[model samples]
Target: MMKKTLTALLTVISLGLGGIGFAAQGFAMGSDSTEPAKKADDYTKAVDLIDDEEYAKAIPLLEKSIKEKGEYADALNQLGYANRKLGNWAAGMEYYLKALKLEPNHLGANEYLGELYLEQKDLASAEAQLAKLKAACGDCDEYDELEDSIDDYKDDNNIN
Candidate 1:
């Protein structure tokens, strides 16, 4: 049921620069993208591995995508998530932060990074990441919901 739960969030999910709540499904990466479509394909494959809960297998594929296109921020963030799933928190966060640097307003980066902080019970950092998501996703209708979720998480964890 974890995949189902995640699929709901990923349906129109995005941790992107625009915060526009782009769908991470259907097209895991841009299909008809004129620029480096190969990278997109590769990224999609990496994501499929993640969805299947094959984190270790996904890592090399993700790394390949990154190698092909160093600026593939999407792959970088996913790689971070994959790392986190494997319980390598530090390396996972490093990739998340790296992706964030490339895309400052990336929603996924902020959310996941906040989650990392929350896991560690670092309320301040978690708050900062979640707080910034609002501004980062200025046009996204889901921001309200996502904000509420983060707030609830913080509250449940006694973050404040």
Candidate 2:
């Protein structure tokens, strides 16, 4: 009887530990693991909308993606681009700043933020962003694009 009791207790303890192990694993994998995938799907959809020049349609998806993946620099940058394309310069600047704060070397954020600065006629700030992009990737497309934008801005305003 004592042996049977001991065996039953051991079985209960083993099951309890096993349950705890499974719960821990599940908790580890639940939100944190699945969130990125959801965010990626949203980001992809947002990008497709943006590519179609549907900034209004892309905003909500980008916002959702950013919410799901907090501090997602790419999503933030894309949000900025969508807002800028929609003529929401203030909102675009906000998202671009957020993205830059999260990732100072983010190519797209630097480029878009530079463009926003140009739109706001903040040439110095725009030049600063261009400098950052240059430092990040000297001959990259982002650097070249922002450089061209700055040049155009200067030409338009006679800034030399």
Candidate whose TM-score is highest: 2
lDDT of 2 by residue, 1-160 (tens): 9999999999999999999999998677632112445466878898899999999999888788767666577788888999998899989989989887877888888998998899989999999998899899898889999999999999999987
Candidate 2: what lDDT?
0.85
Model 2 misses residue 123 by how many Å? 1.2
Cα displacement (angstroms), candidate 2, residue 18, comes to 38
Q: Write candidate 1's Cα lDDT for 24-56 as tens digits.
A: 453464442224454656777888999999999
Residue 30 Cα positional deviation in candidate 1, in Å, after optimal superposition: 5.0
- TM-score (C-alpha) between model 2 and the true structure: 0.74
Give the Å error, residue 119, model 1: 1.0
Whose lDDT is greatest here?
Answer: 2
How far out, in Å, is residue 133 in model 2?
A: 0.8
